[model samples]
Target: MSYSDTNDPAFESMGNAAHYTNIASTLFFAYAVVSFVKDDANDPLFDKSWKQDGFCVTHKEIPFWNSHDACLYFDMMAALLLGALYWKQRNALGMERVNEIFGPSILGILAHGIGHGAVAHRMREMGLPTLAEEDDLDKTTIDENINERIMEINMMDDILGVGEVSERGRNVFVMVCFWVGLMKAALPNLRMAPFAAMVLAAMAGQQFVDRQFAFTYVQTILLVAFSVNQLARKKEEKDFVYATHPMVVGVPVTFIGWIESTQCSAFVKDSFYGHLIYDGFIPVAMLVWYVVCYLQIKESRDNSFESIAKTADRKGKVKVS
Candidate 1:
């Protein structure tokens, strides 16, 4: 069907979601760059106190930016935004679309596990300190932090009916990545190398498919979800503010993921790059997706109001006659 003539409300909703999500993604990207620039201004390397530290802590110890904290915040924001969008546009998009989009989207995020594990393996093989080690922090602490953040971020995924699948898939994907790392470490020339490479390729393809589907799904879901919520609640301002989180978090992450996947595949062999892709990009894309959806929905809403006004004017004239 032609764009305007397309009868499927879900498709229309998807387009709307994409519009809002794009705007949100742009804003978040700008904010992230600004945050990084502000933090980098301290010049930690020149500081004597920084020199006294055992490990090179310039990047980690920057006073203005805590990478881990920023990542957590971004993920949480993305989750909330996803929830808000789904809550508002569930009907127009339909439950099925919601499930399909969310299922693959979550999987796409999980795919980063392979890249993460691969990078860590490469670093260890080359005798470089792994990121977790370089930070002078225990593995347990990082794991705990990740767990907590996962729960927080996955809360919205659960609400939208794809959280469980995605979470399980992520766990599996991570384990696979770990195994790949171990293989790279223990037996770099094993006969299974070709098979392993094939598996990784398949996983990457799956992730891409999931991500693209999820983006479309979220777009469809957000339009109907928000409109329905607004109708029920009658509190537009409060809901709109609440809805902002999805746009802010989802769009940027999605776009970031696309960029990282395309631009940094070479680096994905390193764990740090993997983490950056998984932790950084996914949340950003989701935020972008939400912003795109929001704009379309808003325009649709405006047109609706105008139509209502015109209809009222016509009826008034008829009644007077």
Candidate 2:
């Protein structure tokens, strides 16, 4: 927070770059970890399972920072940093305005971090075929693996297990936060009406659907609306970067995320590297939008003070006196 508050503009950029590099290092480390484990499944934890069940059914996760189970952990850190950034700005921007604009995203990131990291991670303990071998499996074997993969979706629909119920409920809460932010950030228009309604419908029926789909499309929808809003604002402001910079980083990657989820979904589900690139842009997207909102509020405050002049200029305009 103080980093951004300082007069040096490079401070915040440097901090962000450092955090990005740290995460990138973890990802490369994970790839090497995966290679080592598979090359010698003799690691005690996997030795028994690997021998008895073959590599397909043996769990490949490293407890601390595995590919799939660690996103929630990173999400927690991101939420904390994001919260700190907003905390310093809230008072200057007005608490209510900040809450309306930013509070949901901060809470949503934190909430999902806990939900996915703890709850969903536990649900994913069962091993599926590794990325290297998924292509070689026969129909029946592949069918079985597919069922195993859908266990999360099926569990969400069960309504009997208390854990699944709680997890789904938590996801729904995150869904609401996203919807609230979408409403606040995007200017309403007839053009966006149908898309908004469809998202609401999907969200309302999340128990029957894969929660990830809702998240992907919610982002796609929000980004489009956000871009349009920025375009409209650019007309009034005559500042291209102010209106378009957020879109520069967010839109194409999000569209790639959308495509990856729908077309190459199996790859994303099967590979750690795939998930890192496909699903990882999420936090990046959230931060871009948060920055956009911050700039908007600051712009408003700066513009508000310029309309009235000081007494020196008011000397000729003191008709009121």
Candidate 3:
């Protein structure tokens, strides 16, 4: 039996409009980050910022006013908006479709975390004080000017750090919802809620405690489980299979990033090639993944709900006849 076209027109129109809008938004977000990497044209914007003496984006003079800091702020908001947009369309979309929009955004968030960690280390190497050190200042002995400067740096660092962590926490929530939505869209009968909740809790705990290794471990386990779950199905589950790609690819990159952070990997840490690979190349790989996922989703949309309804109707008619 041919699939009914009664609602296909409406659904197709909505999907196509949203699909283009999402692609445009994602490209704009990527361009923003690339533009920042290309030039620090906006550095002049924060010359009068109160905390200009600090070495890191979080500690830079002028709260919320530095070029690098501003990029982070913009990236965070862009990603948050994308995630929220996907959430709003959850019922109308499929698992793979949601991942097509979200997978890259979440990976970018992880990259943002790595970016901050890199900045934190560089600041430490430059002998910059952390927010923790500002408390050691005695209110009475220091000159008013010096005390005020110290307070400013400390406060700015605290605010930026909290913002970073909070952003990651929100990403965790969005990821959990994405997984749940994926399950509902693909494997509707499976009991995946508990597993999804557990995954979220694990990620949130790791984020709160600032445990990157632990978080990575949890992510790895979940990915493997996801892969296994899909393989177990007698019927092929292509979407679930697609879900494993990021997980499998991310583990090695993440481990390398971690290793590069340590003294043991100083050869890679010091070399230009090392910097290129760790800082420049790896993140670009993430951008590539997002672009690929977007294209796949776009190609798959035409055959989605319409195909499902038609297939179901064909079987129903066959049985009746």
lDDT of each: 0.39, 0.45, 0.39
Worst 10 residues of 1 by lDDT: 49-58
| Cα RMSD, model 1 | 16.6
> By TM-score, how accurate is candidate 2?
0.47
> Which stretches of candidate 3 lie above 4 Å from their native place?
1-192, 199-234, 239-248, 251-283, 293-321
Off by over 4 Å in 1: 1-77, 88-107, 110-279
* Runs with alpha carbons beyond 4 Å of true place in candidate 2: 1-60, 94-99, 124-153, 157-159, 162-204, 210-253, 262-272, 292-300, 303-307, 310-312, 316-321
Tell me the lDDT of candidate 2. 0.45
On the 0 to 100 scale, the lDDT of residue 316 in model 1 is: 100
Candidate 3 backbone collisions, by pair: 49-62, 50-62, 51-61, 51-62, 52-61
What lDDT tens digits, residue by residue, belong to model 1 across residues 1-321? 322222334444453454356545544443443233224365222222111211111123222222333333444455566556655655653233233243334333333333333222322333433354637766556444433332232212322323367755665555465334333322222347664764465334334322213222332233333333322322322233234333454444446444443333244314342324446555455546445544545555566679999999999999999
Query: Mind giving the per-residue lDDT tens digits that candidate 3 earns over 1-321?
Result: 113221223443333333333334334433343333223465322111111222112223233333334444444554565556546644543344335435544445444433444333323333433344557755333234333443333322322343467754654444454344333322323465765665455444434322212223333344344334433444323342244233333334444433433322334423422223333434344445545544455445556767889999999999999
Candidate 2 lDDT by residue in tens digits, 1-321: 232222234433443443343334334333333344344544422232222211112123334344334656676787788788777766765234334435555665565555345433444444545546756887568556644553444424432234566766755565555454444444333246764674476455545634333333344444455445444432323232232234434444544443443333345435544344443566676577666656755655455555444644687568757
Q: Give the winner by lDDT.
A: 2
lDDT (0-100) at residue 241 of candidate 2?
29
